[model samples]
Target: MSGPRKGKPVQPGQTVVVIGGGISGLATAALLAAEGHKVTIVEKQDVLGGRAYTFSEDGFRFDAGPSWYLMPEVIDHYFRLLGTSAEEQLDLVKLDPGYRLISEGASEPVDVPAGRQRVVQLFERLEPGAGARLEKYLDSAAETYTMAKRRFLYPTFQSFAPLLTADVLTRLPRLARLLLEPLHSYARRYVKNPSLQQVLEYPAVFLGASPFTAPSMYHLMSHLDLDVGVYYPMGGFARLVEALEKQARDAGGTIRTNVEVLEIETAPVTSRRRPAAVRGVRVRNGGGSVESLPADVVVSAADLHHSETALLPRNLQTYPERYWQRRTAGPSALLLYLGVRGVLPQLEHHTLLFTADWEENFKAIFGKDTFIPSPASMYVCRPSATDPDVAPEGHENVFVLVPIPPDPGLGGSGDERLERAADAVIGQLSEWAGIPDLAERIVVRRLYGPADFERDYHSWKGTSLGPAHTLKQSAFFRAGNVSRKVEGLYYAGASTIPGIGIPMCLISAELVVKRLRGDTSTGPLPVPLRAAGVAEGTVPKGTTA
Candidate 1:
């Protein structure tokens, strides 16, 4: 046939099929549909949201994945892009004392306040003169955050020329410092206390990298968390998903659930350099028969490795199987969804139970061998503490997550090792919370491990998060959003640019759409009111970044 059109905006009524109905996929479909393109999403699951799916049993409801809601501004920005606001669609509450951190050997938990001043005070209490140091650290982090948003995160870099911009060149020294230093090393430069170090480095784990290995540039997460603030949707994350789904459907995008994409169909390109151009997708319908759907463009928001290796032809695959095997993956979580009959007075909405040997824990999870470490650090989310609708009266909805190495050996029918691991987690949690009969009070329990992620999401190595954000796998180093061999075939989600997390996935969708529409503008940078001289270095009262 003909060669795929290049450097052309997707015309109105042009067919676009998006594979995978996850947040990124849905967001991409919505944006394209809003531009008058005929967009359709094919999802394997019975519902939308993919990992962010919600499920209920009896009177309890649980957000299957991504419990923490950081970066409220990102969510708000996304909603605004779609001609609506998060406030108009979803009921959002700003959480004070964002989370509780209980370090090993500490008798009392440290409440991470939403207010920056209170956070400074918390640091001062932990270490003498730490308050001022924290201010300096946050100031540096804020600068990085500003530069990242303006020059990095939203941009679709076709080559190294984008990195040589005047604005970026002016900040070369600062950028170099951030890229060269490890997050742990940078944090240690500010605070001496171990607890404080953990507090600063904790956000790195969410990005699927240990602070020791992750670049200091990621410390911008501190600005996002401390200055920007944490938020919660009234119902849960699922509510946000529902809102996006509505946004997509309202924009004329079609969602087909219970349909699995078998392969991305491509035709030979006239250009000798380019092998093929996307035709559409071959999908196994709900009836169990495979059929092809025609589209001018195809976007696969599913697992990057799976899409390349399984769906695309072997010759067209960008990364080899060996490349994926050598690449470091983010941690796989041992998840426990528990419905407790009574209230947990000691627990906050979000709590981090840390181990005494933090170094060993990281080594065990990301080291050569894959297994659960002893005295593991765990994150617990109790949504019922804030939203009572998630559980029955006097009951609590809790999700306990323990990050472990993505051990391919784990999971399957009759896996006693998985059961033993669950037992260990429960016992540790009970002891840490000082709840004697915590296990007995559980009226409902569901265990999810690596196998579940592999089976359900087709995740490479069952990683809950995507690839680790190491220096070699970040920004331009990460998988590209556009395909090289196949024209009009694009990719999004955690596996591609801007990396992982909910907000990044949303941005990934926007970036892909920008590429498809040939929109070259990087968009406006989000400057806080204080930076604009509307306020003085503080988030306005009752407002989030």
Candidate 2:
């Protein structure tokens, strides 16, 4: 299953099986199929978009996962890779007041508006000298973002040689400090006010980490949020998933729903030195009978732990159980989906409610002695504040996410433990956000917890994303995208290289395509032969370190 010679225009049309129909899987299928491969995506659920799945009931449509759409250039680059553009597929709305911060003990909530200057001004108004410092911080972050997109993000880290290049060697001292220092400490270097510090540190949670543990290199995230701006694709994340599905189908990719992969069938090893080769995937069809789909190559976009530990034979499991045991998983969430009666004017399209005891709250989620916190920091998305089509005429679509310890035993929907956790958050939100009638106004309620994530996504430790981006688990230290133990077997999605989030997952798909092309360069893959414009800062091949 070795790829053709380098720089050769190889023949295509090899049958490729993509496990999991998530963003990475669908996007991988689109690229591969468009390249003349016969690509087929098999999804376990009745629909696609693994975590980005949507559901509707009683006139309310809800995006069950991934509400915030940050990193537009990544999406734009992906759209162009499909020979299309974001402007053509769906309407994207740039959020105003970027997001509302409801902080503990504060009389007024801080509304972070669109644009970098406004944020600087807002910080200036909050604390003297913080505005200028923040500007300096974002400037540094923007430079780091450029460096990462150019030399880090898209490449498959097959060796540490790429990290040893002269350019990287010259910046080793600075890069090491960024990678070793905690994000909280790094943010404090720029901002003095606690609230302003929180704004820069909060993105660690989305990376499945606490500011105390996450690498300061992730300050690059601030550029995406405060500089690139937060956006909401008008119809929700599922709509973006649908658009990717359309792209895959338009490129001749076959999509099959209600298909559970039973086993990743691999050819028996000819030598201990030569790993087992991919044969195909044995899957169970919707009617509960088994079927075999042969493939020259297989990409597992399912949870990496699930794919390696459960699907492959022990010999072929590159990341075994012991490997996962050493990893720190991102926090599992206690999610509340409520269709409340009437609108909540106080809530913005995106609301972040932080507990005053910020460090303690994170300790509750990620500490050695973990437990769900009463005054847990939480995020609320009231889609109705922006998109009217999500809910009935007057009702609001409210989704609450509370980061909790990733304990599968903490229980599931309708359980006492889960309900108690929800109660704690609801009570806190009512007081902190001044939404006095928050509880009683709920006309519809749905609860999801760590156990639900385990059951639905086979998430390791029920983590909402993948492993934490702690200093040890970032960059070259993070899990690789390809399987060294199995020829023609690859892993995608949040669990592998490049880490979590929708945009990263899309890039993970591209990385797999790059691997198949025998393109070992450590940089972003060249924009495919299409004339669609490239995203800002995307590095062309041969120009990277």
Candidate 3:
């Protein structure tokens, strides 16, 4: 029933049911509940965090998803909006030299520092006078990050109209120059050394695309990583999720874990403009009577395609299958979580192991849409190196991630393939970390792949970050925050605009909430998010916009 006309301020007591208790759902529930709306978060998993869940085994704690934590401001902003600080709530520590990267054959390692100047210095060491070039590259990337955040990331554009607006139209040429080029081209121009180029473009590998194909706009990630700094929450990443759950509860939002939403209820109305205005949700329990929860709004933070095609009443669907298929989705990642018996020597908080034949590796994964027998690059995170509490005094906790193609045809026998890949990476890491017989030292180990991601979080094509951040997938080109064909339904997380990583996902939630509530109390743009060309910028109430 279309109970009320559009644009009128309805009373805040209307029930809002958020399906999926991931970062996005919890965030939406928290913001809405804070605004006096009654909210319920229905999650399939037993825990609150979706892919970002945590597990404890054999005296070791592992952050199941999102091993690396970048962009502290996003987390801090969420707290500030709730009248608190991340430091006060979660003991966040700034990790120096954010991560380490090593070429499989090379004996030396490349360290990506936390600060811009330090990063530039490291670049110089890679190549003569590369530091100056790095500064210039970061400057440009920072500019792009600032412009996109203001003009694209925060705004809710149902279609291309907002992007083609008068303001954006006038700046088309400049914006294109900033975001349209390929990342590889941009990096090659600045850093001449192959090693330096590899380091600069490493972040794109996580998107499941090679730097040569990924849009240069993603280069903005470098600025986020270098300038803003990387941080780790004390205890573990699961603690961050726990803190968020607490905030949601404090704001009066109800979160139910181990509850799976089977279907969405909708009623046809002549006045309706979008596909469906949700009436409620039907959920299934372990073994009990089915529950039908009524709500005025149902936000599906679950799989975008799953919510539309499988969960929703098919007869009431708006968009066809072709539409979703055409939208460029990002790649899915295969991950390995292991607890070693002995502390890994010389291992930092974060490390990247790169293969010499990176192009070939990417071709095997992306071009062929299959798992490469030898992955081009892999990221290893040893949280124990930074947080002593993560592992036993003499032991270490390690999480390894290798970005691979999401196609099932390519990834044969997921778990078995992951073991083989993990073994390869462990072999290389053992050599790099100067450890003898690393596999034998393993005390605890677990393997996860695209299938697991698909099952656990309902990720489409088992993608970890939504879709690849290509030229066509950037900004307005990516999925919109609000569904075009569905009213009272919004999308958040990596697949949507401003794309991937924990920080951007968090920001996506904030952007969607701000758009829905029409709350505009944020402050002036923080230096980091301000456009380089803008003479003046205003920040929204909750955001250093």
Candidate 4:
């Protein structure tokens, strides 16, 4: 696909520095540069894609984070803004039997197919009258999903006016149904079977909260899976990173890797009425020397807590360390990336091995004492099952992820703990998936945990998916995208509004662009403006001067 056509340049647009080269940072940079701004992305890692980075060794390739691709429309919307489409740039293949679920002590694994009717049939097989109930449940879920996309996902929360829209008021009843109950309780009201209940409630776990604790609004995730469908790019998530990087570069956004942002430098406002504004970032260069890169505006798509506590001055931080200590974090993970020499015919492209004691498993993760439970629930992804390019001719690339608590103590001294957890995961997979001597077949193996998240991504409390989607930590209650204490400094990532996942990051980027442009409309760019192309002093309708 060709790059976006360059528009009439501004004589001197703002020099915007985006800290972090993750998806959100790249998307923000691309849009800003396309609008005639000078954009640069600074990433600490050797590679550009933060959590979505790909690594290859001995002909085996693996995506380090975010394996699932559930929301395609969000991604398509991003590409559309650049006058392109995801289909034109990436090879996307929708999974057939989307995933396989292995319940503890169950005789057979349940395969969840792509379409709604097929999934309903699977539900019926599990319980006598569940198919009809599932149909009802999904119909409600579809309505909830629609409300979310229209009323919640797209809009910026800078003011309360957006919440008073006619569309949102009309959907208040459905929104109440979603917000007033917990997901686990809501699902139980529809389905009586234990396994079917697990299937309906499982999506909440993806957001790093137990179904019992996560708000029922997240039932919308079921629609994303059963209705919208699950997909994987042919080359894994790494292809997405490559596409975003290309889009950013094509739009004249420069990315500098191995540059660690040590602090955000600021200048006092010249006027007493104005707040402090960003001057630049102080970065540690590859040679371990400090250098400053000046900017008119700064967008931090890095970890929210890291940005507030470590990067900004105490006086400029909006959220204090005590504020973070009181907040709830999403689950951290024990990740195992294994290069196996032989193929496992029994496993599907994606499989979830759930423990027998579901409540106990959650207790182990979110309870005060955080540790890996016996027979822990785990997710395994074999990308090579669908794409042969990720592994050698006779081999498979296996990714094992087990959710654990985000405990700071886990990071300070976690070697012995992680080793024990890895052994438990391997043994569980061996007995459950019929992969005997699983450890012996490993041609290569790398283990990552809370400490790795802290070291590599600077994740707060080593949480992988950002703050938990609890009642207090979601929507308007979540961290604001624009900083109130500092002028020309903004945030866009999992920690900000519209919350977690790849789709949310894309939306977050758009939100930041809207805030920067002073736009209030929660919709895609107008077709006429996109076609006519951007020009100086020609801010689109809904954007302020």
Please give the CA lDDT of all the candidate structures.
0.84, 0.85, 0.71, 0.83
lDDT of 1 by residue, 97-174 (tens): 798888889867888999899899999998999999999999988988877877678876654545678888998998
Q: Rank the candidates by lDDT, best first.
A: 2, 1, 4, 3
Measure candidate 3: CA RMSD: 5.4
Across 1-545, the per-residue lDDT of candidate 4 in tens digits comes to 11112222223378999999998999888877766678999999999788889998889998999999988987987876766678877899999889988889888888899999999998888887989998988988888777677667766666556568788888778677677788989999888877778889888877778887999999888998888788999988988998888878887789999999999888889663336888989999788999999998899999999999998878888877988988889999888988998888778999999877888899898888878777888899999999999999999899999998886557522488787878789888989998897888989888888988988889998988899888888777788787667777889899887788999998898887767766556555542123125564454322222
The number of the candidate with the highest lDDT is 2
How well does model 4 score by local distance difference test? 0.83
Can you write out model 3's per-residue Cα lDDT over 188-252, one digit (the tens) per residue?
A: 88887766778778878656567878877778778877777778887888888887787788878
**Residue 431 lDDT in candidate 4:** 90
Judge candidate 2 against the unseen true structure and give its global Cα lDDT, from 0 to 1. 0.85
Name every residue pair that clashes in candidate 1. Answer: none
Which 10 consecutive positions of candidate 4 have the poorest summed lDDT?
Answer: 1-10
TM-score of each: 0.94, 0.94, 0.89, 0.94
Higher-lDDT candidate of 3 and 4? 4
**Which candidate leads in TM-score?**
2
- Sliding window of 10 residues with minimal summed lDDT for model 3: 523-532
- By TM-score, is 2 or 3 better? 2
Candidate 4 C-alpha error for residue 64, in Å: 0.3
**Candidate 2 backbone collisions, by pair:** none
Question: Which should have the higher lDDT, number 2 or number 4?
Answer: 2
**Candidate 2 backbone clash number:** 0
Count of backbone clashes for each model?
0, 0, 13, 0
